[model samples]
Target chain A: MTDAPKAAPATNSRAGTKKELSEHFKTYKHVWVFIECEYGVIHPVSLELLGEARKLADKRGVSLAGVILGSDANLIAAAATVCFEHGADLVYTVTDPTLAHYRNEAFTKGMTDVVNTYKPEILLLGATTLGRDLAGSVATTLLTGLTADSTALAIDDEGSLAATRPTFGGSLLCTIMTLNYRPQMATVRPRVFGMPPREPGRRGEIIAHPLNLAEDDIVTKVLQFVADRDSNQSQLAYADIVVAGGLGLRSAENFELVKALASVLGAEYGGSRPLVQKGWITADRQIGQTGKTIRPKLYIAAGISGAIQHRVGVEGADTIVAINTDPNAQIFEFAHLGIVADAIKLLPALTEAFRKRLSVNRLAS
Target chain B: MHIVVCLKQVPDSAQIRVHPVTNTIMRQGVPTIINPYDLFALEEAMRLRDLIGGEVTVLTMGPPMAEDSLRKALTFGADRAVLLTDRFFAGSDTLATSFALASALTKIGQEFGVPSIVFTGKQTIDGDTAQVGPGIAKRLGLNQLTYVARIVELDRDANKIIVERRAEGGVQVLETRLPVLITMLEGVNEIRRGSLESAYRAASAKIVTWNAAAAGITDLTKCGLKGSPTIVKKVFAPTPRAEKAHQVPTDGLAPEALADAVIAEIFSRQPSVESDLVRFSAGQ
Candidate 1:
């Protein structure tokens, strides 16, 4: 599908006019979360973002809204209802065939248009593939500020959005501000925010906007949507318990120790980005800024030096236990519990211990 | 089918050290090299150019000293080199960085035929954001392909390309139309050394230099700090843990004894570890 329309005169008043800037900023109200959906399924990160947005909305004393863009009317309506149950006061729905698959051109155009038409002071998005792709483009188009992979979000004393994210490979945390920009934008990594209790039967106002752009004007074509093979998919983000290895594991062969522990815990397995760089593991098993974000109940990190990039990806774990020979490793700084030992040796021990404890518990039950 | 590979000069992160007293990275005198990941992308571009009998151009956006990395790209078989340098571009994060690069790419596209394929390393080790590639793809309207492990197939005549994309849990085999931007994953291919002739050419090749104005960027507001979305308010070192490693003494002990002692200390400190080992052994 292609979308063709004469480029609408950019309604973004903040682009050039100086006299109207103050009025435009004051007129903007409410906090909006862009619900990212793919293949007709709403991503969990979208819900996580809505939960975060609700908090921001509460703090700002403004209504929280969820914006859904897709072709399926029913799906958009359902997502809007879910958003309300999760804490949104209102939901804006934009449905069109062109909006079905996420083509950067159409999706960005659609979402940015909605943002410009109905101004929101704060806009939040999940740091998923689709969200990241769309956020960068939309921010650039609107000439607005956007912070990516933020771990924390709050309104500063000056009433500006303060986005805090780990930087310099997770060695430190830096708070960024999009001052003098309308609709302050930020994308938070999945699992970083706690899931809000869903109020089932809760509902909110649904406002539908017509998609004006025709399919022909869109330059990029979606030849086909190839869903990832089920067998090859890594469910690391959703694992209840996870065991990940790092360079401290010493070699690729040592990664088996990580897998061994993961198997015992019935958890997913992964490693730091360096392990993938070292060919010790595949890219899919990478857990860091550029990799998968995990929020397991318990996370065991073996021989990992927790760089900021890797730290952002795994900081959401309810409990983090680090096993590294270097007691000075960065991973220990944030870990709930730590063992200063070689992962190669300690991993097998931990795996065996967990196996025995679980078995004994099973027998007792 | 001229190809352009954009590479960055980054500090060797493995050798990077934080000064104990200053707590600042000891970047001075640390040899800067072409970003390791970029080498894989450069090699892939060279391979494509070799098979198609075309030229590969290398471009970089950095300080004047970054010419070294561009020359290095030339030695890897890039036929043309361009260095975009200016004080105005300093302190430029990925957003401003991409603006300069996109300008340079547009200029190159004007001089040479528009590149069919633009290559960049999966990400710079320093930033580790992996957003620049996608940013460039968005600006240029090229099909974006990040974390490409292998080029599964290519059809030059049909202008179609298929690649194995690295996703969260597995590889995604995807087919896309060109011209596309491909960010090559590390370990996919080993870089080739420059031959004697290539080395000489690289050393002598005149690298085209451009500034913001020279590259046709008229919007001063969208060039550097003003254009960037995210701003770094501060940079500090991570706080160290309160406790250091508790060591196990093994003075005058045999190999087995030392192992046993270490194991004993571990179990004593973390008693659950002992039972875990016993259970693991039983399972096996």
Candidate 2:
């Protein structure tokens, strides 16, 4: 129920006193990234964040630190080594058996403790399922502002972290600032940033901290982890060349044309978010902001309208070819090459052409 | 084993279109419906309630017109519906939105009982951030299970829940405690239609309406834009690419010639695809 705002008791005798702007701006410090680790391997997005953090740290003349919490010290150390090679200057670790698997209760507690103890001005995390689960909790517990799925991060003239991200279903981009918050927090999607080259000989300082949490204190238990079978995996995100279908394809059977083209291209295949919503494709094959971000060398978008969410996902491609019947389809706006034609007719023709071309090239070679 | 579902009335995204001349979203004549994803959540919640023998309450936050969505929820066999509407609640982002929902949940707990579980769709099609569910869990201190494809088991008496969570590469079978917030993925369950009697009851049901002052929100600054940290300063249409598609002429051309011309264009754009095709054919 709504209630009227109550009058505040004056706790500060100098409530009206003005403070100097220069003195007020000195609270910001080093940038910190939340290193998301599960099972044993660290999520690539975590390393990617570290790489971006390294650039921001250099620009701001500050150190890049990584915050990691888990059960095994050795695993954390290994992760820290990878972070160092990617770019972290220091790794703050909290180890406890309760943290072996990700439980919001324990992971949030461990992370908040690290943040409060070491007041980093900027914090970054991967926008993965586990990272999102923990980032919101930790940010809320600390009563700070957080930006999600940021596409860009920069240090402004005021020494504040400015996070730019797509908004309103990728219709627009907005830059958000947490001016009053001590630590500016953000979550970035995978593959949005390029991975830095690894230097195995690189090293960083590891600050081992005690995790006061225990197993009994943790309320949730990990009964088991059923890793998705390799055969069932979509591998859409890692595809070098992706052929995606859209509503323009018309029927479920028509999707086979896109698949045939993808087969000849030797690329993974997917569809627009609309197709997924229409039940024509599974969620795994949906290529869009909410679905997947791909960085293929080439992308063939057939019958897609190219909404902002879908555009953001494929903007990283080196070359994009769009095939659609609508001359003014949004897909053509962003495509490197566009054809105004029926995908149903063009798809099969394209597939056959590729088949013959490759066979002839093979014979000649 | 009572379950509470938080639903939102969203503009049908598929119907949303940008003005041809102005290049701005024309929200006019866009019909509002229960967010498509939320329907799946409601269905899963109802199915669970049927199996576990408990009441299901459907709650929504929107303009007064959103009452229609709540009534629709009731037609789907929801035991009760609540609508939290207030002018001050407008422009609330996910952060402010979650804070308001969390307070309403507290009210629901006092009146009925603390829900054994709370459900929301993975994300609203309009927002597409998938943050509000996590935001609500953070405020209420609920165990969050997101992207849940299946609920493997639930033992209320033992305070346990096992679910198969959809992850980037695979599914994770996680076991957590009750009183958790779960954002159900699509394809978890198909929504069932209500009988005639249920539809009639929904049509005439007096869905409870609450304002900001009545929802137990004491802080005015934490209710709407004041409470939200993120702000959208600009909105624009996507920029068009610089080049047009290379057309393969089919006029007066044979099928084989047309196919060859198209192939030449594709190879001219991406020569490396030839080698990739070689590898693929080798497998075939």
Question: Could you say which candidate leads in TM-score?
Answer: 2
Alpha carbon lDDT of residue B178, candidate 2?
A: 83
Docking class of 1: acceptable
Candidate lDDT (C-alpha), each: 0.74, 0.78
lDDT of 2 by residue, A121-175 (tens): 8989988888877777777777666777777788877667777665545555555
Clashes, model 1? 17
Q: After superposing candidate 1, which stretches have Cα over 4 Å from the reference?
A: A1-22, A230-234, A360-365, B19-23, B141-178, B184-188, B238-284
lDDT of 2 by residue, B77-98 (tens): 9989988988777667667788
Model 2 stretches astray by more than 4 angstroms: A1-26, A231-234, A361-365, B19-24, B241-259, B279-284
What interface RMSD does every candidate have? 10.4, 8.2
Docking quality category of candidate 2 according to DockQ thresholds: acceptable
The model with the greatest DockQ is 2
Q: Top model by lDDT, which number?
A: 2
